[model samples]
Target: LIGARLSGGGGMVSVAAGVERVGVLLEGFEGVEIAAVNGPRSVVVAGEQQALDGLVGVCEGEGVRVRRIPVDYASHTVQVEEIEEELRSALAGITPRAGRVPFYSTVTGAPVDTATLDAGYWYRNLRHTVRFEEATRALAAAGHRVFVEVSSHPVLVPGVEETVEACGVGSSVVTGTLRRHEDGPGRFVEALARLHVRGVGVDWAALLGRGSGWPVDLPTYAFQRRRFWLESGRGAGDPSVLGLAGVDHPLLGARADIPATSGVLFTSRWSLWSQPWLADHSAAGVTLVPGTAFVDLVVRAGDEVGCGLLSELVIEAPLVIPEQGGVQVRVSLSETDDSGQRTVQVHSRAEDAGPGADWSRHVSGRLAPEAAHADFELTQWPPAGAVLVEEAAERAYQDMAETGYGYGPAFRGLSRAWTRGDEVFAELALPEEAGKPDGFGVHPALIDACFHAGVFRSSDAERQLVMPFAWNDVRLFAIGATALRVHLTYQGTDTVALRLADATGAPVASVGSVVARPVGTEQLRSSSDVSGGRMFRVVWDRLSVRSVEVGSGFVRVGSV
Candidate 1:
């Protein structure tokens, strides 16, 4: 059939949209016929190869997406008549039988008795138009809402969804059995999961029934959204020069030696004007501080005391920085204990807050002696055994933005990424326009970019919005680096060990472990207004003119 069609120059082309308009355009062409209506707008036309090519050109000229079907033969057109005798002779032995189950025939655009599917019927189907859209509509009209295409790939799911939607039939779910190139056990399991999420009951034994394979356990802790901009505070000048004692940290301005108590308080104030890069981090349409900034504060506070390790910092809330006004942060440290560990807590409130305003405690942790570290290196540049994640790694930032993690130029430092067994590595740089890295012990944006690399883990699981909830054994070894190379190895559950280095592979910082938890939009909305503001206006669309006769006793009002 392909040889014959190739000799005769017959082919097909598909248009993605403008169904009605494209149908009108096709009417003026020669030898072309509407081969299939897969969906409301997924239309396929087939005829002489020259006419099909012309149609594709016209569609492209009008800005409609068109794809040429890879085939030398055109079906469902007058060209089939040339092969009619050959098909009849070849299918002469076909014996159609009645089936016990119902069958919706695209040939008839409705359910048909299978007893009528004889060789002649098959021949007619081959030579006639394919009414896929109409057949799908028939299924929807018959109260069928859930559609699972039992095919090797999901070429028809989108068309099924669009067809069912145009029927105005409440709602429907369209899924597929497998996808091309993703025919593995995990993809099949994901297909099952899609059904499960839509209230469908699936057999659990299907996956576990074969082997001793088990699912990887994920973290279940609830956490807040991430949108923090942490600035590594730089010592401005001598604090003792003024009457009061102060800390030279960029984020901290004054230090108060509490009288009669063994505690000390370090204070700093931040505003958009002062730390403009903070505007880059936003979640649920509100600007908030990056969670890494808390780690930065703890690291600085550890330097202030003799402690060099941030033992563990757990976030309790997200610090939302309002568009106007500044927020003041207080990092309070307790006296060293028997273990030489001092409790540290971070709290914040607006600068103009009233006397009775309650301070929001964002994070709390303990500073302790540095822990022994594992020796690691990223000097191999692209890494020895890692492979580019391809499209997933390239689309990292775009995917994050879609899930409410909007990043501006400051935090968009991830250049390239690669993955190896149980580990992900990223190339990061703090954009120069973000600001000078002069004062920071470890610039917050650059460090935060390390966490962004974690998104690549979803290549094996579901894509989710995750935030760093706990920092353990964090220590900064260098300062004022504009670029970094980071390595994150999966520890357990949702935790990873972070190793940071400079462009030349020199060590800058390390985290014994960083634990992450998923963030929900509901939790974000609780603290900020993320409600949708909707407005409506009437639109006039072309309406068909029609008339109906009035019954003897019934009165008809409106004019057509």
Candidate 2:
């Protein structure tokens, strides 16, 4: 088609935003129109070159990411009308019928009648907006979980993943057939392996020319999970030389004993360079260490004191990371009380603070040598009679973005979720690109994702910037979990009892009760030097005469 026909002098660009926003951006440019709504956060517009260039500048100035699609012809726009008649004439002799396996139409975003697939229909398909997002969503809603893009390259896998995530489908796997330059045998085998690892049912008999194999359980710990928390410090000297114990942790540097009260103090430092993953846990345009990290600190401190049980931990304030420089973390332990419990307090301060700067307390908790009996199990999958929170699942990510809790790749672990009487359940996993280390009893991002499904648990009236306020009788049964099945049972107002397990229903962690409360944004700013920026200000410039007058022939004949 390119060699024999006209390549319309137009262009296309994809914007990382909603279709509504893209529509508003093109309101003044009639030559431009939305070609496709690929996903909730992805839209493609095609139109004249001049209009696309202007749109790119406007999007970039507003901090909205947009990219041109590197094409000359405007697709799925009014420009397609120019070749509509020719396309119809060329395809007039062709006939489309129902496939042996049913066919779904992206033009309609659903299954269509085969009789309607005539030359006119083909022409309309070329000129109308593509409904890729809607079609993928319909397939997901119909209980189809496994998707294979049998194309020359993996053009739509990312879009499929985004659409599936938006639908909150329970456990969907998408794989590609081939690649651009690597469409060899090795690539094909790797593609099969990808599907195999994700537990997709495959007809191996067809390929092997032998009997099929039955599925079997993977051995315990057959899968490897990356260690994500408590890494070694950078550019720090050995604390042993200064009568302090060297603490090996990603966020902590050393520890010292408080001889005055027979207590212990744990010290650490943080910077964007030292812990770049912290940048992923952003909320309300501020990068703060997740609340789960604070809980992990409590657990680590518990192990050191022979009190391995976290009785309770409450977040007093958020630990915001400044755009520049670093912050110091201090976790101090009080002397053991009669019940063998020690008071725990966590505080942080900017490294380059003035002499008068004070360590702001972020969390307070207690550690006990023993914990009372508490068990949370998910023996029966999905809990009988649980209904899928379709609305909540579909809007989870979009709603989160609107509320300022933007989840980057690291924190985007939630896949699908459901709810039953007073209970919410979800499926989560560590993304391949999350780059989290192993060795943690429970990775913060994995645990923090447990609360994602709770978006449906609250009414709009109760929604706000909230953090984990209190945790009671928390326990960890397993360590270094990468995939988790979470269950949260609401106790009362803003409280729940959390239960976690591996993919195979093996217990990982449990909490007797959890309490959450909203915090003030001002308090968060006070805790860190990070501040928000004013992207734009009201500029009411004085209305002046136009530099170029509208009309020609400016001779003042009437006045003269």
Candidate 3:
């Protein structure tokens, strides 16, 4: 596998050309052939090292945006023909039997007879081009609704989904078992969770052994939704200073320069009403800031300096929005170190707190100078073979809401979107009616909308409510963007690295990596104590329990 990534099986070339165009290009290549017909413009070429290299050069020289797919062995071409007889000999003794489930053949693009599963059939299966699209079409035509790829890594999920879409299978869902480079057991459980959320019944007892303990009945805790915002003591600075320049971010009040200090401080305030969207996100019924909002603050801070990338950020506390008032927000960026890195921290206190009150640190991170961006030369507008995501803007929030992300008007900013293979291109904007505070580097509403655009690339299983777990190498270019054009490329199973640009396509911000994960109510609850020492506990012994068996001469008893 390492060889496949770095060298070995050589590279696979993806050319955005029609079949005839690709056939003309491969006329002189001896070891190359069309591996698959993915979409109208998606043509893949597999071959030995020299032939693959020549094909890539030819495609690029002709102004085609060719992508090199990593793989070690050249399968489905003449090179694999050399192992055919050996494979047949090695499998000659195997006898095939019919199974409970119908086995569809990717080689034949249809269901195969058990008698045809002979040595020669296996040999040809290995030597032939994988007819994944045809097989998918066959399944769709046969009314299959769910397609699950049982592989450690979901290498064919995108293809399968694309084929299903092309085959006009509207109700179909495509999912996988695990992801590459992830914890096997954890990923397996996650896969099962995905299935469960999609309404797939799983035999939990069989999978986890029947001896497992039964569920314990317990009393549930009721969370207090008391207000926590301070009404006064915002800062030491003159209140009139806010009249100068300002930003539209709730976490940031106004930009102020530290007179003696080398860096700048941004002051802001947050309440449930600061942005109506805050109320839409609650963990265990308590309204706290989502981690993705913090990413907005960090990236905005990174943009203040030349550093656009948030190299690292650790969220320590749940910044709960109080019921009556709100919290005062301050984002501080220290002087740049010798390595051109700066310390960034987010601190907040109740608005009613005294001037001498200590501010609690919520998030801290390091901001580094902009690194090289993985630019896709998107200058070509949607690329040659990209597919436009129809009605993406209309369905973006609806689909996300179905998975527990109930975005409000402020958070529903996806304007339009498109998808090209694994990459998603989208345009997001902060609505003027959102009425955000002014002077934000990049308002959370707008940035959050940028993340929301990811819905365009989501499968049903991926539609769950996910939040940014960690951010790395985030860089900002242009600051205070109300509208943005975003390019999101998949980095892993649950991670996407993004590049941000203004409406005119000017670079705004780029992220090296941002990992996201599905979040549940339990995981989102605030651990901080703001209930004023009021706590509740239930004593199970206080409750009554009675059980009795009844027979011809026995007594029966039951209690509620």
Candidate 4:
């Protein structure tokens, strides 16, 4: 009845033939009016509720099943139909005028001609189907930035969102009735102002003063360039020039230029070495020879300040050989003192005159200072052909879990092992208090924590976080006293295959596929929330580690 009052009741039609005949009978009455010319759709009769119920009963007694809707009255009867002729005569006496802005027709889903706003257009509007969706899409495509639903309830906003996504339209549509504050209209204005600021960086006042138009052109801004120094030659005392290379400079003005000197400092070579080997294989035997060379450089510069500039340089020359049956090589280094004294040092080793000897070999000493280095010597390589699986996994796990919050109890007793050319696997037992009522439960958050620990221990140190982009084939079977095992196989940078199992190695949950990416500390920090208060309080009088085992394993348990 409310909808009929607003639309003039011309769009209602009874689908049932019996109801249509009843509508015809009601139209014959004097009080009612046929306000619309609705076509072969469900007819809406608007009148007093009691009278409508009585009419329904009368129709039902005549073998017509009449269904009464939650409406007030009967509409679109003959009484109202008679007014059409009178309205036509009244409109024919007046001259129509044109409008500036174009108005669209919801009935036809297209623009309507203002000059042809005649009686037929109004009559057709009552019979034709309402193509609201198409009309809304047209408005959106025509660059309408905002849409307001002025109805009593919000029913069109959802349809608009779906339509916009489907049609690939970029305009923002909003429903005003859903605002939370009592002063919703004010809030809407503020939201529009904020949107303008975000889109064009113009304040609301400035936008309003400029008639809400955006600027077309703006001046370009530039930053100051930084300067650096590059050596023209291979010595510290050699002349250097200032330029923008080899150093990262800030966007600030350059510093004051320093005074230059006319005299140039040069370095002298100190040592050099060269070795050559020759061999011949015949019926008699083989012959071989070897030699060596070295060099060093020294630099000297007069002290304009206090101390004279001096530099000692050394070079390890590589070996050179002929393309014949024998080979030759060279090695050398030169050093210069403060007084420009140069020295050279070289050494060579070769074997070329024996049954198992070859002339194309050269040996040299270590080029770097000797320091203690840790190396893992594996008995055999992994069966999967993955090198350093255990070490790499350890590093990855440590890096992933270095959040300083300490790992969860689910990560207790974690261990990893790799079989050469076969597979790399790791297992960890959950602490007893992990999933208890007073302890952390097997919720999504706790699962994420455990995942971080596993990933951190098995990824690169630079990888701060591994985003679990997806989950597949995941299942949770039992809880309490059961450990969780995570098995992972990396395919590439963005894809990984994962399998999750319980303490007994039974497949609890398996994800045949997942995507992951190595994230940096900035991303991790921004993604995580920091809480201030204590997460959990342990009422313990004292706490200490009883003992620590170095080689066998490390275990620490405490009590409150």
Candidate 5:
């Protein structure tokens, strides 16, 4: 029964049944022995293969599949199970000691005490599940980089791959099948060397036995070649004839059959036409249409000067003449042979070409062809008188009230003041409903609204305006119940300081800060892309007051 077969290296040993019966016959009816307890559900029985085969045949006749295990021992069975109590009593008599390397219990998926690796654990393991998968997963989870399955044949490697993938463990599983190939020993050695080079360091000799011999190393070589060739020839007709087949060739005729003028006529219908040059050629002079000729002339002249220099001169509204009806005319210079500098002029003539008794005429300043376009604001007469301050104030109040913010004429009684020189002063009766107090106190929102209204009224008076900058160090005191007054002062356009006070001149809350130049709608919407150095739009929603912090920037609330 002892024989070796050369397959894919590695070894497999099986123990048949009837090992107990053979032991009794060979030793004159003696009892059997269990050599190893591998797991709770299975045992290793040590005996002759012939006796093991006999036991397996008897179990098969009894309708039970007796699997001959790949091992050389008869382990724990009913024969050993009879002495389990005695084994336990013997194990209890010994005191166990700790060891360096960990000992794993095949019954439980955990490390066990080395001293407790005795008959009690062994007997209990014979009836428990072999938690091989659990042990492997736990080992891999603990950062084991490599796993070597030491066995005969290439069976366990596939199982290891499946188990590792199922557990989501990251490890390279390898197998060493030692004695199944004529060159299996050499291949195993080579695999070990490769694993060591990859930082795995596997023990090949210890797992597969050192008696396996090595074989000669073979060298392999391979070669390949690629080649290409080309030939040329001439044909008798014009190469243009090849185009008749609807194929393109580099040697085709250069000249087209149609005349150049006819071809141009065919293409010109679909191409962009130069309207300026076409109009000049058709009319033989400048046209009298403003948009078609005048604007184009202005644009062309501006290009000669510079692009941005004339951008401001293009008017969005139609031009109006003072005394006469509006006439849209495009004027251009006539072609002449003179090399001297010439001026093209556009002026107004108030008289007809015929004889006139009295003619009032005005000639525009002559300009070079390059500086042709100019902006002019024409007026008929001067204003008779200026508007009163009260009227201007009424207009501003009405505008704000209509646009919302709860402003009205009743709110106008809050305050009124004016400055003569380097001073600014204002005093007015606070509305009774505005809740004025004997001492100073003001609501933040009311203070902001009043400042807005005052700025509008004052801008009309002194022609100087105040814009929003930042609010800082704002504190409320002595809440107003009747009315509140405000006092504001500025140092040039850079800094502005303002205070909310009562009619008795007691201070309430103040903002002492600097002001930046007013920003228009366009600048507020635009931002610079730092990486690309380009301008882009910054879209935003409603903004409100959050908190007044002691900082240099305005505080506005919004959701992004």
Candidate 6:
């Protein structure tokens, strides 16, 4: 119910009414009030959800351009009376004290001593109308000419300006800490400049980190620009002649245009010398890319086509990195259809392999527009109805270690787990040492933690071990979460769908389904084998040393 907007009814729709008129018009409605008076004509009405809905219809019928504001609670109305006791109880431990600066009370529409802000007063403040206009006017009358809105956006500055004008304080100045959708530091500097020009004393020395109390010349403008006042003989470069397009992706190199379709391919080569992390993620002394890397590649390709929803990517073959050379990688995306969905595939081969060499298809999937957000509320830290999986919290890693998944410190991010029936809730995070990788939606280590949580075997399970073989319908909402709260629902004996959110429970990404297959240590070891490079010494019998000629002038004669 947060961020719901309300409207005012029971009066002439567009007859130009203020708070007083709107307040009188809403005499019969319960849990309703004029929340704030932004200006002479801009008034906001707050009320309960049901009452607000009904009022919106009435206002619309009378031709009022009624719209709801984005606010979570019905504050400054009778609806807040329900939380009066709770708020009082929450504030009961706090003791009020006097402060040096004067405290203005919007609840009482005047200035008040800080000593009066007790539990009861706090409760009343929530259950009463917000007299923002009154507070602004009172401040202007009390010789407070500067009104600084300490918010990221200037939501209340216009109201303050109107209040000052209504109070006949024409010389009052109104400003804000920062503007919405603007550079935060730049806006703060602008705000400071406005305050300084208005004769407000600022501690420049403290802000600049100069402690010795010595005067120094400060630049009026922070950035120095080259002056172009003089005419130059050099001709300007053509703006149309741009350089080659480059992509700074770790796995993907420069962007390439696909020849036959409206799609793109990101190609690059990876080796131990280039990406040492591949070495860290090896099994049985053989380097192989993790399954999560394929997911990342497919997800990146989807992003290029504006279809980041990875529908299905079956890991056909393992892409093993060689000891001496690298594997040429290609993440290709197909042109999108009418529904904005496209096909994505990951293929790789030996870097020095010719066109005749077959490329191993590592993963193939469908990419579409982002799916609907996962339907799981994470506001409550750990959701109710799920009990902690003690075994998983204690022994999941050990169980995985037994199956050749020797997780290093970076990959072991599984922290907590809870289960209810077929659903599992787990909290995972990369250790501080692991940190986060640049240019990835979610790190492979963090994603692997999700699979680690899936190691939990319920009473119905027959197989003791399983690994993620395929992923379907994956959608990323927010990227690069070092910490996540995952909600996994088992779809079958070997498959599960998961919804992941940030530490605070905001949705990060959702996987429609992840299919796991029974895996053995032998299988993992076989897949991680390094194949191509020569490692053996051949003996050519006695003929190997007899043909050794030291000098270039010694040409081959008859038979040696």
Residues 506-545 of candidate 6 have per-residue lDDT tens digits of 8888888888776565666666543444344221232223
Residue clash pairs of candidate 1:
227-288, 227-289, 228-289, 228-290, 229-290, 233-250, 234-250, 235-248
Best prediction by TM-score: 2
Please list the Cα RMSD from the true structure of every candidate, rounded to 1 decimal place.
22.9, 20.4, 15.9, 30.5, 41.0, 19.2
* Runs with alpha carbons beyond 4 Å of true place in candidate 2: 1-234, 260-262, 354-356, 371-374, 391-394, 530-560
TM for every model, in the order presented, reads 0.51, 0.55, 0.47, 0.26, 0.24, 0.50
What TM-score would candidate 1 get against the native? 0.51
lDDT of each: 0.77, 0.78, 0.70, 0.36, 0.36, 0.69
lDDT by residue for model 5 (44-78), tens: 34344565555545433442223445544333333
Better candidate number, 1 or 4, judged by lDDT: 1
Q: Candidates sorted by TM-score, descending order?
A: 2, 1, 6, 3, 4, 5
List model 1 lDDT by residue over 307-415, tens digit each. Answer: 8888889988787776655677888999878888889999887665656777878899999866535477566555666665665434887778877788887888887
Per-residue CA lDDT of model 2 for 148-235, tens digit only, reads 9988898788788889988997788898988776647767777788898888866665654432232356787768789655442334
Which residue pairs show collisions in model 6? 2-72, 3-71, 3-72, 5-69, 311-473
Write one digit per residue (lDDT tens) for candidate 3, span 114-141.
7679898887775677776677788889
TM-score of 3: 0.47
- Which 10 consecutive positions of candidate 4 have the poorest summed lDDT? 291-300
Output the lDDT of residue 331, model 2.
93
